[model samples]
Target chain A: MTVSTLPAYPARSARLKRISAEYPHALGLLLLAPMLSWIAVFFIFPTAWMIWQSFSERGLQPYATILTSAIYLKVLLTTLKICVITTVGCLILGYPVAYVLTTARPSTRAVLLILVVLPYWLDFIVRSYSWMILLGRHGLINQLVTGLGISSTSLPLLYNLFSVSIGMIQILLPLTILTLFSTMVRIDRRLVDAATIHGASPWRAFRTVFLPLSLPGVYAACLLLFVSALGFYVTPALLGGPEQTMISQTIMVIASDLLDWPLASAAGVLLLVVTTSLLVLYSRFFRLDRMLGGMAR
Target chain B: MRAPRASLAVNGLAGAVLVFLLFPVLVVVLISFSSVDFLSFPPPSLSLRWYRTIFSNFEWINAFLLTLQVGALTALLSTLLGVPAAFALSRHVKRGQNVVNALVLAALVTPPIIKAISIYLYYVPFGLLNTVPGLAFAHTVSGIPFVVINVVAGLRGYDRDLERAASIHGASPLRAVLGITLPLIAPSIIVGAVFAFMQSAQELLIAMFVLGTLEKPLAVKLWEGVRVAIDPSLAAATTSVTVLAILGLVTVMLAGRRARPTRVAVQG
Candidate 1:
């Protein structure tokens, strides 16, 4: 009995060793299969099907319609215009906040960072609703204006490019600040001091030394904001007027209201092209991990 | 020896921007207690009537419950899927890692509107529209990125020697990971789960396409309400969401704090 058990122990140990040796490779594939399959089925396949549907029946007519029709062309241009506005608006409002975050004490920086990011957790519908309450005719802004005798009549603040820009900027400002702060915090302050010691003024030291280093962050933020802004659906839909209609809203209208799947798919494909190209350009310059890391924090 | 302080103008600008960011959400919270029916700031009188209404109204209550269910389901599914993929990406895969990474993160860059339309079309053929599970699955696509990103960041900072130590002590590889690795990364997993839940809760675009009139999430209900009317009830609904969001943010902050000491211990 003892001799038989001794031989079985060696066999069992060998089996364990073999399992350990071969496990990681097999395990990795097993681990990845679920998510990879889910994405392929739900995301990749659907996107491909949509693209195929675009040309399945009309055979380029939808593309021609988009190119030839005044409405589609105008909507595309308006979408671009709004995206540029949102990107610029976020930069102007967010840069100083990020700069201050980098310069502040750690406690103050933590508080400030929380303030910027807290809004990100709130729902877009709620944020957009808040904007409506503030910008409506008898809303908060008008109430303040009227109560203070600042204007005889309420300002048209609710449904325009200005309102859309404000709402979008507010929504995307946190992303801009976080991205900029992540990069700005990494710049060695001693470099600026080195420049100042070399006889440059304080502002000049920053301009020459720090600003160039921060450009990569600014470019990445703008690209991210611009691409994100291009996909504005809720904010623009809730805040903007007819003339301010974006391509996303146009697509929804086409798909749901007009019931034109092919036309909607064509427009979606067009939006996809522009966004993917910009992202490809971004990937060429900056690592996506850095951007995602900044966001996750 | 000290750096020059940020100028007064910069501080003031930043302060103003912070105020701009906080004021709207604050107004929504404040207006939810309005005594009157209409939406207004600095309400004539404060009351809990809207909150009571939200709790009592069937439509509002149903939507809120549905939103919570979907959020929970989405968080669970994404984590189960994302953690393994994150592990595979960070540890095991040697070849085609970049391709896999790109594939995983692709959902992050895809516009939500495009996702909504395409998924809506895809679901129609499969009869997946308007079901809670279907909605959760649709949301899981977006939720995967948050979980993967947070978990990967957590894993990057993790000390691999600890796992090897466990293995040397006669633990199987799987046992080492379950007992040693996962416990260390629990904070990240929590943060990821919270974000995924909040994202699914607040999501409206895909929900709008997938859900029908009979069953709606809070976001869709609020959206439909805002477009049609501006009332204290909408403010009440918005405030409830605001509270949930604040709670989620606090959880993440606490998770970050909890993660710090473990990291310090690992380094030391």
Candidate 2:
């Protein structure tokens, strides 16, 4: 478009030069057109329409229906509950990993850190399927239990909150560890040493010195994890039980199975509001670079 | 020096957590070699029978090929579209820059399910569903943020003097950027490209919505396989994708390592 808009060469070369000199930033603007256009047409337009459709469908009634409906509120509550539980689970599981990463010998820390990052690099679905194999009745855990003669029946490990949580905790565990580890690594080790020298116990040194220092990482991790966990569709949809379906699963059913775009859009708008608010907080205070570079050092 | 006793205990617990994280993948790999028809741990006997099944199956192969095609194109397109936008954000108009930044990275915050549903509703009339180009376009939205982040980092660390020198002497702004700036940030761009590939290749929900009636990609295929039953062949598929993901990540790491030297040179 820029090329075509250029003035015809013979008499207009001066004019073309004048325009280019005057508007140096125009090239940059021209460069952005393809991506901006695509995003506008595909992403922004759809999102705007979705929000509008939620209100326009039956004339501002979808919002009322969703807000008033017990089923919708229950699903929203389940989603929030799951997000809280998953955040807590990640903290408990990830804190030690981050602690070790900051405290271990360099060689040992690198290996330990890589182990966490390695799982994150894998496809979540593939990693999740690993749980699928282990949790099913015909799976190994069951085979072991039955073969050991401890129980006559296979454990109901699949399609439950426990299984879903296990899978998500594993997937989300890396993010928490990486965030907390970055913060923990920055903590001045001498402060903990200073506390130890004053006759405080090791636990006291950690609680009074280290834990408080690393709280930012914990905050960052919790905010990032909770927001991310809220949007989890694949793992919960695949691994969760009928009773354990989260808001995302409900949205999927409404969108595809029920063909209720208004209801689906309403659910989605709710999810978007909650997640975007948390994420805006994250993006405001944190650098994406640090999030990725936890192990780079 | 050896760590304190309590620290050693913490390290041991960390090891166990790592095991918990990696245990499922190891189980999947082991079960893939199961000689029996069903998934049982410590297989009755080891065999390559499942891998053989994937190799023999056309559906599996087609899905793999389509995944590769879509993933590669998504990577390429995201890079082309994203790198320029990154450049713009790095040194362009300051007004409305935050607005543009939010718009570009919007895909990251929005739930994939929401994107999938909204895009599906939007795409039905356009009949863009079930096409590789359609899926790639949807995926590119998610991938652009990686380029913006990585390349913007590169730009932040770069010396603007070189581009400025080129433009002041004789070169146009476009030439200065294309010739002087791009090569300096090429490594970051590559990392962004790899990220784009991984984002698309691992993507499932969006693929599910956009690829109706069309041949499913490996992600959809893998999802269907596991949902129906976790078989040895599904294990093989997961293993293949995992291997590819690891390979991609390792490339980014190596590139990042190489990136340090260039940055040091610029700083010096």
Candidate 3:
């Protein structure tokens, strides 16, 4: 009787284990349900609704108006211009920093990295406000110039294209540096040493071997910087005059000040389209996971 | 060795860029202590008047508290939603993984202004506008990507054998996960929480639309102040937020250092 009961219990437990093992996929589905549902309701639904709202009232008329209207077209162009400038500025400023970070000793790299990343973690409002303090009429730059007798009066440094560009570039430089550094660090320094041994000058070796290898990183960084700069609102709004109105600020004004929901939605859709297309292109070249992973580190 | 001249140039350029990066931050912190009414490079006398102003003013205090509350809520909600999703994505749900990933990360790719406007419109019809929960929910959509990215990374380095061992030792699946996996990944979750909190706290565009008139977070309050006029009080508010952020960063770094050894030991 004892032997028969033991065999029966073993058989029951084996069946239960099999059932549980088979249901892992179902368990996964259950686990994913909450986040997926939350995203669908809060993220996807609103986005689709906004797109629908854009075309609901006037069909494609709003798009046509945006295309034809001088103000809207100019704002879009200005946004593109600022984004290009900011991207270029970040590249020029960030490359040396990234290169230094990749080649520096571990201890020095840690401190340099912290200095670069500290501003990134700060709020845009803080950074932009800081820029205002430095660029305003009584700002440090103006004060320095006036005190040195270089100029009799303060320069109109705040609320201009120059200020806008400076603020945006400063804000975005860390992102560019980090992205470039991630790619640069992966490159074998031995390759450059090889070129040098083979009678190539250091500058020539960098230009021929290292530069080509690092171009992909440059492309990726520029894409990210341009995409980010395109969506900028706070820096431009604070540091720019009416001339530097970005597509984002325009959307805000249309939505809030003008009370033009369809036009605003249409403008938003256009901005979304441009940014999404660029990112999609970016993902085709580089894995999104790697980019995000690089940023997190 | 490479030429000394090139190395010196690189170091000099890097140093200049670092100074450029940090100068504005330094200026802001310094100006916050000014005794003068107007913006100035050098404070004639150092004073706590602006800090006192921020503390004494009801609106500023209200905004600060609201921002903290929203940030905390966003961190909690995103982590609760994101951790399980990370586990599922990394370990389970094999089919359509790419599609799911893209869907999860779509928020990060989408322009912030688009997100702000869309959420603002959606919330208006649902009567969710100007409510803390509403704004928190909006922020959570953005926050989830940060949480998922961090937690998924943590899970990738994790060994599945630990869970298998737990099960073999008669621990149920849920019990094993709760007892072992969660604790092991707690540092990642905490870091994710920090990112989520910072994202929510620093967010201005969405908060501008979602919490328009009745409620204001610190970002919005600063935006208003900066738009109207530049004041030392604005500098004081920014300084406070920057200091808080620095503390958060320091805490995360320490936590990461402490967790590193334990993680390495477990793997070995």
lDDT of 3 by residue, B143-180 (tens): 88778888887887787677666656655556667877
Residue-by-residue lDDT tens digits, candidate 2, A178-279 = 888878888999999988888878898889999999998888888878878988887887678876788888888988899888988988888888877777
Ordered from best to worst DockQ, the candidate numbers read: 3, 1, 2
CA lDDT, every model vs. true structure: 0.83, 0.79, 0.83
lDDT of 1 by residue, B64-179 (tens): 89998999999999999999998887777767666666565567767888998999889998999989999999899888878887888788889987866665555555676887
* Interface RMSD in angstroms for candidate 3: 5.5
lDDT of 3 by residue, A20-80 (tens): 4777577678778898999999899999999999999999999999999998999999999
Count of backbone collisions in candidate 1:
0
| Top-DockQ structure, candidate number | 3
Task: Give me the runs in candidate 3 sitting further than 4 Å from their true place.
Answer: A1-31, A149-153, A292-296, B91-97, B156-181, B248-268
What DockQ does every candidate get? 0.46, 0.42, 0.48
Cα error, candidate 2, residue B120 (Å): 1.5
**Chain B structural similarity (TM-score) per candidate:** 0.86, 0.80, 0.85
Clash pairs detected, candidate 2: none
Off by over 4 Å in 2: A1-38, A105-107, A143-154, A197-200, A294-297, B1-3, B85-105, B152-187, B245-268
- For model 1, residues A1-297, the per-residue Cα lDDT tens digits are 011122223345456556645664765687889999989888999899999999998999999999999988999999999999899999999889888998999998888887888787667777888898888898878989998999989999988999999999999998899888878888999898898888888678878998998888899899889988988889988899998999988998998899999999999999999988877767666654566453545
Name the best candidate (by TM-score).
1
Error of 1 at A98 (Å): 1.8
